[model samples]
Target chain A: MSLLQQLRLGFRSLMLHKLRSALAVLGILIGVTAVIWLVAMGEGVSYQAQQQIKDLGATSIIIRSIKPSEESSRDVGSRFGISYGLLRDDYERIVTNVPTISRAVPMREISREVRHREYAIDGQAIGCTPDYFGMNRLTIARGRAISEVDMKGYANVVVLAWEAARKLFPIEDPLGRAVQIGTEFYVVVGIAAERTAAAAIGGSLDARQYDRDVYIPLSTFRARIGDRVFTLRAGTTQLETVELTQITAVVEDMKEVDATADIIRSLLQRYHKSVDYAVVVPKELLEQAETMRAMFNVLLLLIAGISLLVGGIGIMNIMLATVTERTREIGIRRALGATKGEIVRQFLCETVVLAGTGGLLGVAFGFLCGPTVNGVRMAVGAFLPEVWSALPPNIRNLEPRLAPWSIIAAFAISVGVGILFGIYPARRAASMDPIEALRHE
Target chain B: MNELQPTVDREIVASIVGVSKVYKLGGHTVRALDNVSIDFRQGDFVAIMGSSGSGKSTLLNLLGCLDRPDSGQYILAGRDVAAMDDETLSRIRGRYLGFIFQSYNLIQQLSVVENIEVPLSYQRPPLPGGRERCLKLAELVGLSGRLGHRPTELSGGQQQRVAIARALVNNPHVILADEPTGNLDTATSHEIMDLLDALNRAGRTIVMVTHENDIAERARRIVRLRDGRIDTISEVRPALPVVSGSIALERL
Candidate 1:
């Protein structure tokens, strides 16, 4: 028989038990949909992580000074104070020694309360050079950033971050006004534009919020704030000294990021007594994110494949029952001169129809993944505000990215599952004795 | 009783020689057919009759190529079909034989015309004018008006007529009917037999198995089996003159 005729026959036969055939199709539909939906969600999460890493600049390497533990700190300190962190000399050495370094910005930050008049808010005071604004992609919205003249003369000038400007100068413009920071008054020169938080990369980098920082020239911070600061910890007054907190080095070429990072790591190892620093290359982090995305997709595929297998098993079960129930029809066709191969083709055609229909329907539903996720997010945010607030920023901001490959693979595998699971039942129906089948009640 | 031989002047379409079939039923071997032999000529109508387990059904099954004999040669259309493989045997059956069942064995899902076209679907090289041929056969069996009706919608006699139409759609060398009127009332039985009689008169070859003597009398010859052996071969009517120069005769 022609394939078309066989398919028509198969469809007609399946229509005899409509509910049974529909249930079988539903099994495959669920499996295919699961494959597509899970892969989309996984891709969205990994995409978010990779984008954050890319925002950090692929050619930049961040070196942060970490405080040593108490045991390691005791040996490096004198009775005056314990100082175990990057010094001003390390910054100079890295800039002069690394040939691939295009530009390096040294920064030191301390948490303190800043006030203008009676209004006060806790904020970070960042001490850095003029290049720090350009390297960090921070733009100025009002007035101007700290200039080269301000750094050369150790001028008492500051730039307010977006949120800091809004809080300290709530109703009035704070430009040319002085804000007091720990008994020192610094004039505001500029206000940085608004910026979103950057996601944490692995365990080395913490999630950064840029809204509450107050910027000043490195020379001014060293001369005014000084290196020594006293703090009461556990009812004891302790003194700590630190010069520079971080150095961000930008490589001229992306290919030299890893080699330059290695050179800087060895140079620092020779100078520091203990491991009190971390070198983070955004380029390396981007590569790791790519690898993680691949592994996540593979894991999703494995889980989807199991569900498809279960769906295939359901198809086989239904088909076996159909073969048994239609034994007499098989006999009739055989008696009318149908070959064994023809019988097999007929049954196999029915299964392909079942699986193919489910696959198509599943693909249609997969396209709804993005809208469904957004709808659920909105519903939770509206009805259960506390629970929605409790969700991590990643989940709250997630956008399911439907991968085209997942759609195609899911459809092809569903049909393949049909063929793979269909063979045995088709063969069973074909091998029955014609006389016995005809005589079957 | 002596077995009658085929007339030498007529062309033989099928013949079985020294055929025997044995079956194992619950570990006990039952001889379904024992050393049976017969010849069927073109345009001939023959009926096989016997009591239950008398081997009439077994003989029909062997003739239909549904079962292979334990020992013997059964030739059809000049081929030794008994030795043929399953695939070749199926091809032979599609090319040379048609079947009508007692229960009107029409596929429930198919309409009358579609059921009639079932045999043609199995023909190798595929028969042409598929729907047109089914329509013509339905008209021949007086079921043209019920072409779109399923078997369940038809009466017993109408269903049997549909089966008869299906048997002729392939235009085989022999048409095998297993108790064609077995499930019909007497009036409906006569109606179905009348359709068969007309087809037989139109130069078609038919082989029927029935337990009713009256039903057997409709054919030209009746062969009775007893205890797995042929008991008698009787002629109820003389063979009609074949319409020579007809398309069927020309093909043969």
Candidate 2:
């Protein structure tokens, strides 16, 4: 028979029992949609994670000073208020030795109570250079950030973080106002924008909360605080001295991040007797996140693949019943000069049509993933604001990115499933004895 | 029983020599047909008659090429079809034979014209003008008025007429009818038989299997079988003269 005729015949037969064919098609539709939806959601999640790592600066390396363990604190200077961790000399040595280092910012952070017209709140005072704001992705909401002149001339000026500005000033403007910090007064220059805090990543970096920080120039901090602070603890007066709590060095190119980090690590090891500093390459973390995203995609695909397998089994189940029900029809066709191969082709064509139609509908539905998720989010937010707010930021702002290859792959696999599950039933129909099949009631 | 003279002037369309078929049913082997030999000439209408378990159905199956003989040679239009593979046998059946079943085995989903077009669809070089040919065949079988009707909507007699139209659509060399009128009433049976008789008179080679002696008497020759063997092959009393040119026209 002509292929077109065979297909028409098969279609006509399937249409005779519309409910059965629809049920089979529904199985395949659910499978394909599940694959696409799950993969899209996974891609969205991984994309958010990678974006977070990229925001940490892919071409920058961070060196944080950690106090050495007691076992390694054998220096006799400890009794005389001798301090540990990275110092300003170490930061200068890095900028001088590493040719790939394009720029480096040194920061020292201390907690202090700030009072502006009786609005006293404990906040972090961060001493940094002009490049610190951009390197850490902090934006200025008002006025201007601390300038290079503020650092060079040791200007006693400060920029208040978003919440600090809100709490200290409330209805009044905080710009040009002097805020008292531990008996020292500094003028506020600018207000930083509100930023979401980043969670600690892989034990290399601590969680950073930017909303309550007070920014000051490193030169001002060195000239005023003097790196040595004495405090009364229990019954004894204890003194500690430390400088340059962290150094964030930016590389000229991403490819040099690892090599420069290695050079910095060896330089620190040569200078410091104790292992009190850690060099962290955010570039390496970005690559690790990429690998993890691939693994996540594979895991999602495997789950979707199982659903497809179940769908294939569903097709097989329905087809087997159909073959049984049409035994006499098969006999009639064979008697009507249809070859065994024609019989097989007829049944296989029906299944492929079922799966192909379902796959097409699934691809169409996959395109709706982004809007669907947004709609669901809106609904949830309207009905239960608390629940919506409780969701993680990654899920709250998820934008499903449909992979083109996944759409094609899901469709192709569904068609393959039709053929794979269709073989046995078609063979059963084809191999039937004409006389016996005709005799089947 | 062997005194009948074979018509030598007619061309032999099909013949089986020493054909036997054995069936195993529940561990008891049944010899359905044993050493049956017969020759069918072109343009001959023959009826095969037997009671229950008389090997008549088995003989019909073997002649229809639906089953193979355990040991024998079946030659059809000068080809040894007994040794042919399934694909080749299907092609032979499509090109050489047509079938009508007792149950009026028209596919219930198809219309009369679609059912008739089925056999023509399987033709390799696809019989041209299939719709026109189906319409013509429907007219020939007196079903032109109900060409679009499904089989379930038709009376038993009309369904059998559609089957007949379907059988003739392929323009096969031979028509095999298995108890063609078994499911109809006496009046409808006669109506179906009249159509068959008219087709036979138009020079179509027809082979019919029936249990009714009255039905067998309508054919020019009757072959009677009992217990897997042919009991008699005799000329039936002519109820009507062997008339030719029932419809005067060019043959397909």
Which candidate leads in TM-score? 1
Q: Could you give candidate 2's fraction of true interface contacts?
A: 0.63
Compute the DockQ of candidate 2.
0.65
Models 1 onward score TM values of 0.92, 0.86
For residues B1-252, write the lDDT of model 1, one tens digit per residue. 223433556678899998999989999999999999888887789999999999989989888999899999998999888888898888878879989999989998999999998988889988778888888888888888999999999999999999988988877889999999999999999999998898888778899999998999999999899989889889888875655515653232
Give a tens-digit lDDT track for model 2, residues A1-441. Answer: 666766677778889889988888888888899889988998887776676667778898989877666567657257766577788999999999999999999999888888899798898989999899999989999989999999999998999999999999988899999998777899999999998765345353434667779999999998987687687879988676778788999998989998999999999999888887778777787788789888988998898889888888888888889899999888888888888988898888878877877788888888888899999999999999999988866678788989888899999999999889989999999999988989998
| Collision pairs in model 2 | none
User: What's the number of clashes in each of the models?
Assistant: 0, 0
TM-score of candidate 2 chain B vs. the reference: 0.92
Q: What share of the true interface contacts does each candidate keep?
A: 0.75, 0.63
Cα deviation at A53, candidate 1, in Å, is 1.2
